[model samples]
Target: MGIKIGIIGAGGMAAYHIAGFRQAGAEVVALCDPNEAVARSAAAAHGVSRVFGDAESMFAALPELNAVSVIVPNKYHAPLTLQALAAGKHVFCEKPPALNALEMAEMKGLAERNKRTLMFNFNNRARPESVAMMDYVKNGEAGRINSAQAKWVRRTGIPGFGGWFTNKVLSGGGALVDLLHMIDLSMYLMGYPEPAWVLARTFDDFITDRTFKGPWGIPDAVNGVNDVETAAHGFVSFKTGQALSFQISWAEMVQREEVSAAFQGTKAGGMLRRLYGADGVDATATDLCEFYTQDHGRSSNRVVTVESDPDMGRVRSARNFVRSIEGTESPLNTPDQALILMKIIDGAYASARSGEPVKL
Candidate 1:
C-alpha cells in the first residue's frame, strides 16, 4: 500500500501540496483548515475522504495517517509540527520553517526526540537546474564556492497588502520569509556553509502608498496592519570565508522583476535565472543556467540546459518524504538545515534593527 497523507491548511499552498502528493502516488486521506468551509471544499475538490476544522480533530479522527503536509501560516509551523510529531506522524512543513530561530530549533529537537522525519517544503532546490548546479558544485567542478549574489526583485508587488503577509507578528518578516527560497537555494548550492555574521537593512517604503500595490490590490489595507518591511538587503559571511549578498523586495520602483542567483568559486562560476514574470507566473521564457570557465587559457561560458517542470520539485519532494517515512531514503530538507537558515534570517533582522553587524 502507498503512504497515507493528510493536508493541513486548505488554502492555496495546500492545493499545491495536493497536486504534488497525487503526482507522487500518495493517497491524501484527510484535509484540515481552521475554516470549516474551506476544509470541506478542499476535501471535495481533492477527493479526500475526511475533513476537519482543525488539526487536532483531524489527527484524532485519522490515526492511520502516515504523514501530513503542514501548510499553515508561519507562526503555527512550530506548534503544528511538534504536535504532529508527538502524534507519530511525519510532517512536511511549508517553507520559512518558523517565525524565528528559537521555534525552528525547538521543532528540530522535538523531531529528533520523537524519531520522526521533519521535512521543509523548499521545493526550489529540487528543480532540474538546481539539481545539476548542486552536482556541479559538489563534484568540485566549481572548486570552493567563495562569493555569491542572489536577488528576487519586483517592480511593484506586495502580497496581501495589509493582511497576515504584511504583518510581522503573523508572517515573521516580509521579503525575507516570502522570498528566502532563492537565498536558501544559493546557500545550499554552496554546500550549506555556517553563517558567520550578517550586515543588513530593511525598508518599508511603499506601505502607505497605494500606487505601489500592483497585482495584490489593497482592499484590506485600511483596517489591516502593515508593520513588516517591504524590502530587505543582506550581506552574509560564512565561517568558511565564503560570502553571499542578497536583496529581495516585495514592492520597489524598478525596471522589472528579476529572480536570479550567481556563484563564483575559486576555479569557476555559474548563474541561474528563473524566467517568470513579475507576477511570478506566465513563464513564456525558459530558465537559463550558464557556467563561466577558463578553457585553454581562454575565457569561455557554457549554457546548461535543464528540463523545465515548474512543479517537478514539489512532486519529487513528496516522493522523497514518503521514502523517508519508509526508511528507504533520507530527507533532503531537514529541520537542522531549517534552524541554521532561520538563524541567518534572525541575525539579519537583528542587524538591521541595531544598525550593526550581528554575529551568529
Candidate 2:
C-alpha cells in the first residue's frame, strides 16, 4: 500500500501538500485543524476522507496514518511532532523545526527514541537551481568554499501588524526567522560546516517607523509593537576557518526582494542567481531563478548560468518526503542536519543579543 499521509494544518501551505501528495500517489487520509469548517473544507477540497479539529482525538481515531505534514506555526512544531511521534506517525515539519533550540532538540530526540522518521522541510535546499549548484560545489566544479554569502532582502512584510508574526513570543523573531530560507540553503551547500562562532545584529525599527513600502501594499501607517526585528545580519566562522555572511530584512525600503547565496571557493565559485520570489531587484522580471558558477579556468569573473521554473521546489520536496515515508528512500532532510540549522539560528540570536560573538 502507498504511504498514508495526513496534513496537520489547513493554512496556505496545506493545499500545496495535498496536491503534491496526490500527484505522488500517496494517500492523504486526514486533514486536521482546530476549525471544523476549515478542516472539512480542506478535506473536501483535497479529497481526504477524515477531518478532525483535535490532533490527539484524530490520531486515536485514525490508526492507519503512517505520516503527517506539520505545516503549523513555528511555536507548534514541537508539540505537534511529539504528538505525531507518540502516535507512531513519521513527520515532515516545516523549516526552523521548532520555536527554540531546546524544543527542537527535544523533539528530534523524541523522534529518534521512537525510531520514527522526522524530517524538516528545507525545500529551498532541494530547488533545481540549488541541486545544480550543489553538483558544481561537490564535484570540485566550485573549489573549496571559502568566503560565502547568503542573504534575503525584501521591500516590506510587517505581516498582520498586531498579529502573531509581530509577537516574538509566538514567531520567535521577525524577518530573521520568517525569511531564513536562504540561511538553510546556504548552510546545506557549504556541506553543513560547524560554526566556530557568530556575530549578529538586528534592527526592529524599520516597521515601527512606518516609512517602508509594505509587501502586500498596506497603508503607510500600520500599528504594532514591532517587538521582532525586521532585519538581522550575521557573520559566521566555521571550524574550517571558512566564513559566511548572512542578512535578511522584511521591512526594508529596498527596490525589490533579493534572496540569494554566493559561494566563493578557492578554485571555483558560484551563486544562486535568483532565490525565492526575488527577481534580483529587477522590477520588470519574471524571476527565472538561475544558478550561476565560475571555475578557476574562467578569468572573466562571469560564471555559466542555468535557469528553470521556481514553483517546482515545493512539489519536488513533498514528493521526496512521501517517497521516504513509503520506505522507498531515506528522509530528504535528516534530523541531524535540521538540528544543526536550529543551533546556528540560536547562536546567531545569542550573539545579536549579547553583542558578543557566540561560539557554536
Candidate 3:
C-alpha cells in the first residue's frame, strides 16, 4: 500500500500539507483539531475521510496511518511531534521546530529513540532559486561561505496586535521566530556550522501599534497578550571561524518588506532575495538570485533565474518529506539541524534579555 498520513491541525497551514501529501501520492486519511467543526470543514474541502477532535482519537481510530503532518502553533510543535513519534509515526512539523532549544532537543531525542523520521518544514531550501544557488555552493563554485547576512524585515508587518502571534508563550517570540526562513536559508547555504556565541538585541517599538499590523487578515483578540519583541538583530560566530548577521522584524522603519540572504565565500558570493510591494502579500513580490565572481581578473556577475514559486516551496518541501519516507529522496532538513537553529534563536533571545552576548 502507498503511504498513509494524517494531519494534526485544521488551521490554514494544513491546506498546504494536505495538498503536498496528496500530490506526493500519499493518502490523507484523517485530520484532527480541537475545533471539530473546523476540522470537519477542512476534511470535506480536502477530501479527507475522517475528522477527529483530538490527535489521540484520530491515531486510535486510524491504525493504518504511518505518518502525520503537524501544522499548529509554535508552543504545541514539540508536544504534538513527540506524541506522534511515540505512536510509531513519521512526522513532518511546521517551522521554528519548537519554542526553544530545550524543547527541540527533547523532540529530537524522542524521535531518535522511536526511530521515526522527524523533519521540519524548512521550505525555502526547496525553492527553485535556492536549488539553483545550492548547485553552485555544493559543486565548489561558491567555496566555503565565510560570512553571510540574512534579513526578513517589514516596515508595517506585525501579524496582529493581540493574537497568539504576539504572545511570547504561544508563538515563541515575534518576527525573529515567525520570519526565520532567511536565517535558516543562510545557515543552510553556509553548511549549518557550529556556533560559538551570539550577540543580539530585540525591539518592541510597534508591538502594540495596530497601525503596523500586516495584511494577512488575521484578526486581533480583544483582550489578548502582546508581549513579544517586534524586531531582533543579531550576530553569530561559528566554530569554523565563519560568521552571520541577521535582521528580523515584524514592524520597523524600512522601505518595504524584504526577505533575503547574501553570502561571501572563498571563491564566489551570491544572494537570494524577495522584495514585496506590500507586506504579507505574495502576489506583489519580486524574487532575485545572482552570483558574483571574477573571470580572468574581470568582474563577472551571473543572475540565476527560475520559475517563481508563490508557495515558497511549502508544498514541495512537504512532498519531499513523503518521498524521503519512501526512500526516493533525502529529507531536506533533520531534527539535529533544527536543534541547532533553535539554539541560535534561544541564544539571541537570552542575549537580548541580559543585554550581553550569549555563549553557546
Candidate 4:
C-alpha cells in the first residue's frame, strides 16, 4: 500500500507541500480551498484531479486519504489539524504550531489520542548547515551548549501593511511568531531542554509604516487592521540551567537582513547564519556555518561547507514528514517540541504585556 495524501488550504505553501509529497513518491489525491477556482487551479497545476471548496466536504468524499498536509493561516491550523486527526489521518502542519500554548496542547492531545503522526515544518532543521552542526553536537564535539543566541532581523521587511501577518488575533504576533525558526533551531541543538522562564519586550515602531513593507509582494489590505508588533527581544532560561537570547523583527534600523543562530558549548562554539542582500529574497542570501574551538591552546575556526538550499529546506522537511510516516526516518521535530516552542512564544508575549518575567 502507498501513502495517499490530501492537502488543505490551496495557497502558496500548499504548492511546496505538493512538490515535496510527490517527490517522496506519495500520491497527492486531492486539494481543497475556500475558493473553488483557486483550488481547481492548484489541482490542475499539481496534477491532482480532485478539488473541493472545504475540508469537511473533502474528508467526507475521500475515505482513502490516510494523511493530510495543512498549509492554512495561523488561526485555522489547530481546528483543521484536530479535525484531520480525529478522522484518523496523520498530519503535517506549518510553523508556529498554533496561536498559543493552549491551542498547541489541544492539537497535541488529539493527535496522541488518535495515534497519528503530528509534525511541524521546522524546515531549518533540515537545512544542510543545520544537519552538519547536529552531527558535531550529537557526537559530543560541541559538548553541552550552555547558552545561545538566535536572530532573524530585517531592515524594511514588514510582510504587509494590513494582512494577517500584522493582525494579532489572526497571526498571533508579528516577527517573533512568524520568524521563529532560529529560536526553535537553537533549542533543538541544545537537546530541547524544558524552558523555565522568559523575559521580553516588543516594539511596534514600524507596525503601521507602509514604507517598510517586504519584497514578497503580498499586497496591503485596504483599511485593514495592523496591530501587531514589528520587533521583539527576549531571553529564556531552561530547567537545565542553559539559556537562550533572541531578537526577531520584521522592521528595524539595521544594516541588512540577517538570519542566524550562535551557541557556546562547554568544549566549543558554533554559528550558522544567512546574510541577505534584500529581505524575503532567498536568491540574494549568503550562508555561513562554522565552529570555533582550541587547537593546541590556539583559537581555531573551521568552516562547514555544504550544498546551498534555495528553498531553505522547505521541501526537504516535507519529504521527511512523508518518510517518517513510512517508518523509514524519524521526524525532525515532534509535537512535544512544538508545544514547548509555543509556550516560550506565549510567555514572551505575556511578559511583554505585563512588563515582567513570565515563569513557565
Cα lDDT tens digits for candidate 2, 1-360:
877888898877777677767777989988889888988987888788988897887888888888899987777888999999988898988766887878888988888898988887777876777877787777876667778788888775666565567777767888887878888788787888887888999887665655453545223324544588888999989998888899889877676667787887776666674533343334554344333444455564544455564454777778778877677765557887777777878898898899999998
lDDT of 4 by residue, 1-360 (tens): 889999998878887788788888999999999989999998898899999998888889999998999988788899999999999999999988999999999999998888899999899999999999999999999889999999999998899878788888888999999999999999999999999999999999978878888887368999888999899999999999999999999999999999999999999999999898854445776778999999899999999999978888888999999999999998999999999999999999999999999999
Model 3 over residues 186-250: C-alpha lDDT tens digits? 99999999999999999999888899988773699999999999999999999999999999998
- Give TM per candidate: 0.95, 0.90, 0.98, 0.98
> How many clashes in each structure?
0, 0, 0, 0
lDDT of each: 0.84, 0.76, 0.92, 0.92
Q: How well is each residue in 40-73 modelled by candidate 1, as lDDT tens digits?
A: 9878987888988888898888888888999887
Residue 318 of model 2, lDDT score: 80
lDDT of 2 at 360: 86
On TM-score, who's better, 1 or 2?
1
lDDT of 2 at 19: 70
**Model 4: residues >4 Å from true position, as ranges?**
279-284
